[model samples]
Target: MTKNIKANGLNHLAISTNNMKEQIEFYTDVLGFRLVALYWMHGVEGCWHGFLEMNDSSQVAFVFNPANKDAKVEYGVTNPGHTGGPSAPGTMQHLAFNVDTLDDLLNMRDRIRSRGYNVMGPMDHGMCHSIYFQGPEDTCLEVATFGNADYPIGPKDWIDPEVQELAGISDEELAKFTNPIEFEGQGGTIPNPGYNPDSYNPDRPVQLLQGMFAMPDEQFAMIPMEKRPPSMMSDEDRAAKHAN
Candidate 1:
């Protein structure tokens, strides 16, 4: 049987940084994100990791590998910055951060330009107003703002039925996708998937943290209930558990 799960919001997005210092400076100084934490990556040798907090739940994290110092990025492939293009499969194409208002989006455009970046558009993208720019490591970035859920940021007429048909979405399927049936939480333990990896789509992650995906079904179930990601643990509790 299929299970229903609800996710509140993004926790963070982690990306590899060729130059951690440059990434940190760009995000913290230029973009106005507060540097929350910088620490050695646990269990990894000669690596550094840090977080730039957008808010309590949202963050942009960077992982620096000194071992790959001389590696070259293939622009438009590995790195799709500079007015945006395409990236290799399994590579992150671009990242968009949310702003609260259209005024905020316009101000962000001015902010980017003031920093000497060739920023483009508060483009009217139907769903949101967005500004695009390039950042360190050829990372394509966008800032966007949308109206409240009750209001239509996009006109109903803007939705093209032909495109929907071309995408092979039937009216019923589209209805279901847009207005999904909400599932009430059981408020119990995470259920064992009881499935084989061979039957799963490798690209579709059932669960993820940062950029990492869920463990193998059997291995995931073996984890003690208290050690699960959702289980709350204090510093002392974690220390005691680790010492066990």
Candidate 2:
């Protein structure tokens, strides 16, 4: 029998940024999200992480790395440039956040415009109405509100057969994709099957990768636990760091 486990919703969504301060301002000041956590990213050198609260449990996080400043952004490659455009495969084409109602969506649109940024949409997309805008560092932002229906989105009705054919998904493949099988529990019976160099490929050097795979999971967990939160740091400790 499959274990009774499922993921309910998002805990947070992390986006990489070169300018943490600018991203923080856009999320908090303009979008009215509360600043919750700001600290030096654990296990990473010279990186800063900030979180803007989306709800009590979920947040929108940004990571700032100095190396990103040297990276170039080519529209349609780095970013789509708008809500509907092309981006490199595996990249986040756009991020759409959820709101409760149409009124809330419009109010957010007004708030963004008041901050001197142009927003497009309040355009209806059948199941939801959305507003599109640009954020710092060519980030495409969207806010949407689902319609007040018993089942706001019907996947069966929404999935087009022609589009499915174009994507080369057969009936069996579509059924499997839509409804995935639940995993049976192993009850901690699996052994560490130590790393294999031939089977695995890493972008970084094998020596560096081997060192990481060699460490016990329990020992690695302590590395992040050593760093305290930004708010808890003392004056002398604060001087050694930079986070806004």
List the global CA lDDT of all models. 0.74, 0.83
For residues 157-211, what per-residue lDDT tens digits would candidate 2 score against the true structure? 7788999999999999999888877766577555456567777556788787777
For residue 4, what is the lDDT in candidate 2?
54
Candidate whose lDDT is highest = 2
Residue 26 lDDT in candidate 1: 90
Clashing pairs in 1: none
Look at candidate 2 and tell me the lDDT of residue 88. Answer: 94
Measured over all alpha carbons after superposition, the RMSD of each candidate to the real structure, in angstroms, is 7.0, 3.6
- Error (Å) of candidate 2 at residue 32 is 0.9
The whole-model C-alpha lDDT of candidate 1 against the native structure comes to: 0.74
Write down the TM-score of every candidate: 0.70, 0.84
Local error of candidate 2 at 235, Å? 5.4
Residue 128 Cα positional deviation in candidate 2, in Å, after optimal superposition: 1.2
